[model samples]
Target: MIGRWIFIRGQAMGRRGWLALAALFIVALIVLMPLRMILGLTMPETITARSVEGSVWGGRIGDLNAGPLPLGTVDAGLEPLPLLIGRPQFAIARDGFSATIAPSRIIHANGSVQIPDGLGGLPVTSVGLGDFSAAMADGQCTEAQGTLSLTLAALGPLLPDAITVSGQARCEKGALVVPMRGPQGMERLTLKIGGDGRWQADLTLAGLPQETVEALKSSGFDTRPGGIGIGTSGTF
Candidate 1:
């Protein structure tokens, strides 16, 4: 009788062990499902992409666009642990550049992209996002780093050479601000972009040839302390 009891008990234990293993396997299946199943379920309004393909562990986002900027096709992968807690983090990359995107922060490397409509009607043909990183908490900018550049064209004879203005990015009054300067500091452009896609730019010109200054003034630029200034605002 004792031998029979022991055998039965051992069998029961083995069954429980198999049950536990099965439970773990089911959880893994649910967590590792393909990302394509949920790609468009809750996409943000400010972001759009041509398509996505692959598993949650590794995927691709094709022709992604953030606001008005186009981010080329990028490889993406999710951090599974974070997803478990409802805060999904993605590791994204394209070409040689990489970045991490989370709920409250974004970090990216330098990249040059063309702007179809330009920036706030400033005749900017292209924009370079150089080493940009920004973080937010409680709807406020907590940290910011990196620089940005804008290339301009169609200035007629006023600016024969290609004009590229660049400057470091910072946070001010809960907005991302970039104060760019042209060669020789002869021109200044302060650009601000808010979280809601609203943007504004102030362009000022100084230390230019008298004829250049006159030309700008004739083009609706107001005379300021150091030179002529123009302000424009629009949605990004």
Candidate 2:
């Protein structure tokens, strides 16, 4: 008789625990319904969201876009249990990309960004080098893994006849220095970005052959002591 009573008590406690968990889940859903609705309606002009529905604990954003960049759609949800215990957490995934976002720069993450053809309206494109120098150089390229900023004025010094410069590189950050040699001798084109995210450029031409220097001058470029100066700015 005593053993049977003990077993019955244990089963009852288990039932109570499960019932409590179910109650909390319902409460969480109710509390987060309004917030999820607000986020859906307030989607920023810079971003477009599709099929945004679900409570806080679980939800899906079908597709998203910002300017020329496409973020596709993703499924995401809030994880309040971990957050309540002092660990901020969330989840995201879209086709080939997946990551668990948290504080501390990054943790428990693995993903890759893909550009099938290339980004639009920007300086460098996969198939084209539009708006950049037409200079007939060896067509050098750097890592495509970082941010590149530059002004259009920096590209004009290229020989006008030259067009459609193409090379291979991985994406990356830092100034893009193009090495070109001609009658002006050896020099580099350095494109720098300002803290304000503006593009500026300089021609590091020094000790150029006089014939080449004069040629650049005649091409509508102003000469500094050591190099030719050129540049371009927004909406170029």
Candidate 3:
């Protein structure tokens, strides 16, 4: 009879222990669920996020800023599976950019972004980006098309070869120019700041779009056969 009683006691103790553990799990979720708010207070100074909404399990950030650069709005959510492997990852996205950032590196980050160097956020003068601000400000289409795959470097900046462009030219001037040849006759194109922090192109467009040629006139290029040269330096 005593042996049977002990067996029953053991069963009760096991059940009680499980119940306690379940309770703790619930509490932990509650405490950590509002991780977005916590992030605002603790995130690195270079990153500024506002109006954090969502639980620790997942969340959204409105108007996230990296120093003076505005990231607009971004959404980040925790992935459940990574937790099992002793590492946690958050899938983050903002506009044309998306990536999962972890302690070691940024995962599957793919997107394109322009960086500003001059007073008007234009590329530096040394890289020959004179036409960037004017073209962008007028909403003119450069017809540049391409994909952006980003991987975080051990240092803060993006690693070399992180930027890839496919268009009429790999680069021109101080910009990674992507002048897409399209059905509309390649009248437009796109340009982004290159990895060197200078906006210079490695290759100039062989076939210049009429609009691009006109737009770049001030920057010293024209629709002429070779599409004008970039080596010469002057104010247009």
lDDT against the true structure, each candidate = 0.78, 0.44, 0.46
Clashes of each: 0, 13, 17
Across 62-125, the per-residue lDDT of candidate 1 in tens digits comes to 9877677777788988777767888777778887456766655667756777777777657888
Query: Which candidate number has the best TM-score?
Result: 1
- Which lDDT tens digits does candidate 3 get at residues 1-236? 99999889767787778789899999887657786655544345556676788786677878765433455577887777886986666677877777665432235545544444321322222111111221111222222223322111111122122222234333344344544322333222243443233332222334655555565566554443454323212110
- The predictions' CA RMSDs to the true structure, in order, are 5.3, 12.2, 13.8
Worst 10 residues of 2 by lDDT: 128-137
Where does candidate 2 stray beyond 4 Å?
1-35, 38-45, 66-68, 81-90, 100-236
Model 3 bad stretches (over 4 Å): 1-31, 37-46, 65-71, 93-99, 103-105, 109-146, 149-203, 209-217, 220-236
Stronger candidate by lDDT (1 vs 2): 1
TM-score for each model: 0.79, 0.35, 0.41
Best by lDDT: 1
Candidates sorted on lDDT, descending = 1, 3, 2
Error of 2 at 121 (Å): 4.8
Candidate 1 Cα misplacement greater than 4 A, ranges: 1-32, 36-43, 80-86
TM-score result, candidate 2 = 0.35
